[model samples]
Target chain A: MSTVQITRLSMPKWGLSMTEGTVVQWLVEEGTILEQGDEVIEVESEKINNAVESPAPGVLRRQVAKEGDVVPVGGLLGVIADAEVPDSEIDAFVEEFEATFVPEEEEAAGPEPEKVEIGGKSIQYLKMGESDATPLVLIHGFGGDINIWVFNQETLSTERPVYALDLPGHGGSVKDVGSGDLDSFAGIVAGFLDAMGIEKAHLAGHSMGGAVAAAIAIQHPERVASVTLIASAGLGEEINSDYIEGFIAANRRREMKRVLGTLFANPDLVTRQLVNDVLAYKRLDGVDEALRAVADSLFPDGKQANVLDISRIQAPVLVIWGDKDEVVPASHAQNASSGAKVETIENAGHSVQMEAAGKVNRLISGFLDEAES
Target chain B: MARRITFMQAINEALAQEMERDETVVVFGEDNAGGAGAPGEDDAWGGVMGVTKGLYGKYPGRVLDTPISESAFVGAAAGAAASGLRPVAELMFVDFFGVCMDQIYNQAAKFRYMFGGKAVTPMVIRTMFGAGIRAAAQHSQSLYPIFTHIPGLKVVVPSNPYDAKGLMIASIRDDDPVIFFENKVLYSVEGDVPEESYEIPLGEAEYVREGDDVTIVAIGRMVSMAEQAADALEDEGVECEIVDPRTTSPLDEEAIYESVENTGRLVVVDESNPRCSLASDIAALVAQNCFDHLKAAPRMVTAPHTPPPFSPALEDLYVPDPERVAAAVRETLGTSDRARA
Candidate 1:
């Protein structure tokens, strides 16, 4: 059989900080036939836990890494191949891969996120992959950073160069949110693309970020290729203002954990590290005022203040939402423009891109490809 | 992004950032700027362990190398704080606390209360504590319990690099006198610390590891040992919840009580001597308040009443290790013999 018949399932590097993950357990047993995006194993990093999906559509031939085993990113976890594939072949493959594999070296360190002064304000963004396809730019929601794309960026980057940016008042960027409005956020992103010298690129965003992307597509149609919204805002007037207020007021871990639980379908997924990270961000010098400013501007009186018309954008629009999303109701997916394709994923929550990363990534990459084509 | 740095570097960064932020923030202690007047090079020694190594050059007049007199310098540090300047005075080894007890405990600790809150002693007295580098009796003693006993005095014991920076910044900004203790063995230990200036509020205890079998309250360097013990206990089906109090004074009584209430078993591991130590103090608190939730008697793992040993073998035996912590946990759970303590 050709080498293409077998595919190795390896540990995934979730974010910039994650170098390795421990195998929590095998979600699916050997000999179980799985679709390409089926979750095969549960792996945990220090920051959070995620399900590792199958790389190929085939029967799980062998479990190379056992439960409770610590594996570095790119280290083989299991093997997938046709049911007729010999068992000896899978064993030999695992052994050979281990012998040849070297842990990711610092010498080949991926490009570190770069910070630029956009309109005299510091903007932090990470540029990943290098390919001859339409670049994809990712914008995170309120209280989120570039890490919101931890699941989708690396996966989707294989098809083209992808950019993930930290909005003002988040992550490594300066805690100054001028105007603290959607228009300002859209302007900063447009300026970021200008600084990076990208003339036009596909845009994707989450929650509040979706509004920014939609605003950009409306404001600067010449600078956009396509727009993809994941559990996005601005389509509907109703939003979970309690979550926004709770996130801003949560200085302690317990409160922050409760606020983050609204984002995920599984409340258990809101790990200590995640809560600590959000708390640290909230505690920054100007973060509180910035968050309050943005909240007052957009989500005043517990309502989405501004609603953009996505149909006006000439570019293709793909709106994806988690059916179980609590922060922004998944029913808002239906509010998408008639020209937009809306997909509501089941059992996922506000962070559909992270909860169902496999399907979300596939949908995003495919949409971007068709738009670029 | 979080940049991983040594405990020593974290302390240095906190000092630098605070000094840069406020002109009133001054750093002075013995050998703070070691080679100032007599040597060929300037900014040579940045304290005994170089935690303040490069500060002399960055802030010329602010980094003062005081005479080798603890009473004089520490007294001066207190005086400066009361006079409107934020002084960060390094006590070098906490064993030297005896020479300046009146200055720290009497004057600085009492300024705010005695003066009816009219005076604010924004001073941080940084010192090295714990027994690890064979520093022997005088140098290795964890004398924070003495400071914790005194009212109006805040005692901080940071376990790792991240806490070291945050607590240092917080202590510097605090209006009252703060005793910041750094473990000698933890100086080289490395962890993630943010480049920006942020403070971890005092009195908040961090749960290093969460489990249900037993509550392990470990202070300072003992926190890491408790973590190691928790890992070992996990293999034996004995899960441990480890709590690092971070600050001895203004202790988070609620955290300790809540933890013990959940597990029904308590083990406090402190590197200080057994008498009036944090281990004994926490055990008593849990015993008193969490009485109804207790499944067994609270256990304490502490150093012997004797001074630390000079020899490596005896010193290793004298200090509380993971084995002792694990044994204490097992004893509290009735899974091991009590004689091991």
Candidate 2:
């Protein structure tokens, strides 16, 4: 008799903040064969829902964790082994694994988001990965903070250092928006780079942040290496005035749910936790005034107030949009500079980066590679 | 950005931010600023556990280190509040309340009523309580009930770091005297807390877990224990709704009544002794308000009528555990308790 090899399928850490996940369902059953990259199970974390893929090809020996079980990250969810393995051997392996398995303390301190004062205002940012490659800077859209990049930051940082920043009026940054105009917001982005001593780097912006990025590329082209815009705002004249007004006016939970429903093509993606987070942020003092100032300055009569001439942008640009986006139409993708490459994702809404994370990540990575070469 | 911090750190941040925001706010307690007159470090010990450690240096003259005389300082805090300053006096251990009962209950708690509503005692008494860490009988007691028993006093018992920070800020800003109880065992427990100061209003009951079968109303550290029990019961197809009444005085009776009416079953897990406790109070409230809605007699899981013991084995039995809470919930569901027996 020959011994068989075995592999344990454990819950994966999808992002920096995910400490545990609830097993939603098992896509594969026991005694079934699986190939690498096959979706084996569905897991739901507080932030997002994603499927766990198999790491190696094998027969599904046993499902150690049942559906609906909330297991800590790295806890064994199932076992995969060659068909030659005896049931007795699999049982022994699982027994030993369970006896020695100690869940890591979820609250163990990790790299924390830091704050720096620039121009007498506090700016919050998170820096991940360490590489000599040109650093990537992420700027969030209107009413968003660094958290909007939660899905893309860790993945992109693997090959190069990445910094996700909260503009003055968002996230943990100071709530005061000095002028709430593209020039004022863009100047703060430049000041952030100067504060960090980064002379030039790639800039990726979403929605309103895209406008800030375009403004920087136009006025201070020497500081920008490349630009990637997701459902950008500066290239078009038409804007969803209803979304702007609804987002600012909605204070109750039900109202918030309705307003946030516009951000996703599948409204089911809007969970209770997401609504609670937005409400908590809005309740903070000075946030209301800051948001109102930005909205009044940028979108005066339900229209884009700072539409930029995309043809004059000097940096290599990549434009990505969601075909079903309701906030900013996908038609705006055609307005990009002739040199820009454009891609529109189907079955996604305004939050294309989050709705189609894998595709967006691949597209951005490919664009960055070409720009670097 | 929100970051994980210990319960003690949250309290400290709340005090520091409140003091910075309002010059009228001042902190004074025994060893809140250690080595006040000694030749060594001036701010050596922030408190017994250093909950107020760095505030002395930040505010300079605002944070004071008082002698071990609780009555004098507590009375002085009340007098200072009446005179205009919002004083937050630490009682060190709530067991020491005997020495300062007159100052807290008679003077501070009754001033507004006796002075034709002209007096405003904006004072806070922060103290540590609860049995754990082997801190014998006198040092460990869940005495928030005693404070909650008094009229004109707002009692706050926060379970996690987020609630601790918010409740502390609200207490400091409140115009009435407030008693803030800290569970010593929960000092090191961590949770996500916002860097910016925010206030959670008094008398709001937070539904920690939403379910349909039973409503579990818990207080202070017991909230975490009830959550643990709720998770375990979930596997057995027993769903539970857990509620944390952040404030004992001005209790959110409406939240409890609504949850109990929906679930039709009630189980209260409290760390204090069973006699005349918050558990008994809440159970009574539910029985009176939702009598027709209940499916079974309300169950209470609490420490025995005796004081907290000293031996580790006995202390383990003294504190309510998740197993005991689950058994009580099962009893309310008319399930057999013979399995545990």
Candidate 3:
């Protein structure tokens, strides 16, 4: 018999505020051989419901947490090991791991999102990981905040520093979107990089943020290293005007839930907490005017207003589109320049990064590796 | 970014933001601007405790400093509100309501009804109450029950900084008269508050902690005390569901009844005196609405029927603590009876 390695599958911290999660169901049972990035179990928090992916290739040995049992962050959920490992040794490993486990209090406290003033506006951003690698800055879509990257930010931060920023009129940032056009939005992103003392960095933007990223590449090409657009706008001239109107008009939970359902392929992703968070953001003092201004400037007469000339971008570009996207159609992926690589993800919607986070993360990591080399 | 701030700071922010947003919004009270006409300096005190400090300089003439007369200023506030200005009048201490009872109950509160629904009196009476500091009998008193008893008035007693900010904004924007009660002891307590303005609707109860064994309803500062008791009870395998009714006038009756029906046991923690207070009011509510589902008689943890004591030691015993609240929960569960026997 050979020595076996056991991998403890623990509950993950999805966002800054998540303290515990309930195991809704197990997608893969004990003794099932799992590959890395394969779906292992489905977990539900107050914010959203997403499937937990396997971190390593192994055989599932024990399901420690039962279905419907709520487990605190960092609590053990299951164990994965080589199939050749004896049952006695696996049991001993589980016992010893449980006996020695101590939760980190500081991790529970977590780091608060920091705010910086750029051009007289308060911009809030959350930074994770610390490395000398060229940093990646994440800009959220219209009516969204840094929280839209709740699934990808922490994972992407493992290799290098990742900064997820709340643009003007979103999240904890100042609710003043000056001009509310692509140029102004991109200028703020450039200002954010300047405030953070970052000379040049990779930009990953979603939805309207994608247009902003493209604008940054066009206007301030010196500040951008590469660009990644996910379900981005400005690629074509057609948008679902009803979604924008509904989101801006939604005030109550029920109306907000209906509006947010358009973002995800599975409407169940729009939980009550999600709807409440959006409502809270919308209720902020200047959010209504800011959102209206952006919508009017970007989507006029139910069509995309600013179509970017992507061929002028000097940096390498990766454009991701969800085949099932209702907001921006998948057909727009063809509009990318010949130099840009476009990948269309299936079974996802406008929120493809959250719905298919594993695939998206792998794609981004590989693209970043290639770009750096 | 969202950051932790004291309950007092939250109130100040609400006032500042509302005044900045609406030109019709005005603030006035005794010493709200500190040195109104003193020989030393301008904008002197900013109120008894510095809750309204720095606003006088920011708003110029909007933040006013008035004489220490509750009846006159409160009445003036009602008049100004009815005449198209939104005024937030600070009553200094809630115990002084005796001097201003007529203005609050008769005029401001009844304006909309008296004027055949045409009058929109947008007035907020901000007052300090509760016992914690050695304030003695004259200053510290929870008189929310009196305001809650009024038909046309909306009484709000927020427990933390987040609720304090939200409820204050809601009160300022409300078309009717609102009595915004601030607990003196809780002024320094800190909680996370968002920088941007948001309003928590009145008449909704927030479930602070969810459980299944016993339902604990708390009001004002007592909400924190009940939360502490609930956490301790969890250690002994007794789960408690804690609810905070942010407003007393627009009481969330359905939440209380649903919680009582689910848990079958109820415990109410109120810092006010035992008789004719929020404790008795909620106990009567649960007993009447969920009588068939109740497993045991509802219990109330409150101060005895007397004035707030002056001495620190006596005052410590006068207020309801976590132990008292936990003991009351145990009593409702019949576990305390076993210990007594």
Candidate 4:
């Protein structure tokens, strides 16, 4: 039999603040065939429920972690090898990996987010992977920051550079949102790219960010090569004013949890950590006024006031939305003009990027790839 | 900056400096913005007592005035804290804790331990405590011991303007939930406070007056009385050691033990009722912890176990005074082992 080498399968870090996770169950038994991105195990953390995906395709020759075992990030959970590898070597390798493996100190420190000042305001943005490919800038919705892309950024960045930023009035960015309009928000995004010295790149945005990306392509055409909108705004007049109003008005946990629940098809995705994130933003000194200003000025009566003129957008636009989106109403998908390609994801909600990340990623990747070709 | 300012001004300065230093610090309470929803000038009150006066204009939107609803806003502050906001919620009076105690004791205090140690509720509840303002029983009370009883809550009672300012700033930055008590009577009393932002450790106690004759433990407003009693005893050559436990929950029991060990005599001055009061608690702690060091039985001078009287003369008698505290110290000093029996 031909000898086969296998890499030790280490525990994966799913989100930004996940330090350690409990291995709830292993999906595949020992010596099972495993494909790249296959769900090897289910790990539960303080943040969210995530299925650990296999990084490489191989036969799962050994399981190092048992069910209901608590392990730190980077601890070996399993081993993958070609079927040709002898069983004796696999058994010896499992013992050695467990006995000698030491979890990385950096993993224990958790995912560290970085910040840079742009336009005199501190902008927090997380960069993943070291690919020479042009960086893809990910902008979150009205009340989100860089952490929303925690699920996709690291995985997608393996193929190219990826960056997610906190816009003004959100996350670590300056709490003051001047005028709290899309134009100002788009200007800040463009200014941020300019400050970072990026001339052209793919832009991906969620909800309100979708409209901002659309506006960016229309106004600063040279800076954006392509645009991807996830449950984006500016597509139509139909939006859940209740979600917007509830988000702005929610100051307590129970209330914020209910409002955030409207963003996802699986209301369970609106976890305590998620509500805590929004509360943290709302509690900041100027964040409440900033949010209120944006809500009043942009979506005063539950309708988006700023709509991008699709005709002016020069870049290729790919619009993705959840068929069951309660936030921006699935009806808005009909508003996309002739040129833009639209895909309504079934069994998803307002947070299409989060609920259907793989499909959304494939759609965005294909659109950008065609644009590059 | 070193000159005297009212306790309320000192508190205001501490809050203003903290808000300036950290963008996360915010101040909100009923009438915190003064004229909320009113036709006259905005921020007319700065607070009900004008302690937060001028902050609304200085840090617009940061200092907020909420509706009379305490639970909603106080719980909001706790929720905000768990997320990322370090909010300072004012309950107006500690007596009003009835309206928002769940937010403070249950939510803010337990987030750390109950969340599997993943959450940090960095919040501060600032409220007026103690009596002598003639605000009646409903608006006046020293409930620090009740808050101190909660495991995760840090109860802070600053005895003077200096401790009030420093401890308020410290409470704002502390990772655990802190209940900061401001004696209403001391708010108008002047003292020297630093202009810069600084923090005094939460669990530390300060020895105001050092003497070996007797160890007097006081809290909040009672510290001043103990000091006065110590001063009056100086002429008679009966030197008294005064120890102020700035925080009751993270009680500086070691400090009390050490003072008792040195003085071999103890007298506790408390403004609260004599039973189950902080004074009695401290007296019990010293009696149990330093039984061998005692020259006489521990003495506690406190108000009667009853609601604070409404009349000025009766109220004055109801609150523990310096003369009474001095008399307790003298009684404890005069009694020998045979005399005590």
- Give RMSD to native, each candidate: 4.4, 6.5, 4.5, 18.6
Q: Candidate 4 — which residues are off by over 4 angstroms? A: A5-9, A26-35, A56-63, A79-89, A106-120, A130-132, A309-311, A337-346, A362-367, B1-14, B17-341
Model 4 pairs whose backbones collide: A280-B84
DockQ of each: 0.37, 0.18, 0.36, 0.03
- Ordering by DockQ: 1, 3, 2, 4
Task: State which candidate, 2 or 4, has the greater TM-score.
Answer: 2
Candidate that would win on lDDT: 1
> TM-scores across all candidates?
0.85, 0.72, 0.85, 0.56
Best candidate, DockQ: 1
Please give, as one word, the docking class of candidate 4. incorrect
- CA-based DockQ, model 2: 0.18
Q: In candidate 2, residue A117 scores what lDDT?
A: 90
lDDT of 2 at B264: 86
Model 1 chain B weakest 10-residue run by lDDT: B332-341
Q: Please provide, for model 2 over A98-164, each residue's C-alpha lDDT reduced to its tens digit, 9 standing for 90 to 100.
A: 9999877876565568999989999999998888889899989989888788778877998888998
Residue A319 of candidate 4: its Cα lDDT?
A: 82
Q: How would the candidate models be sorted by lDDT, starting from the highest?
A: 1, 3, 2, 4
List the global CA lDDT of all models: 0.89, 0.88, 0.88, 0.81
> What does candidate 1's lDDT look like per residue over B181-260, in tens digits?
99989999999888888888798888888777889999989998999999998888676888899999989898888788
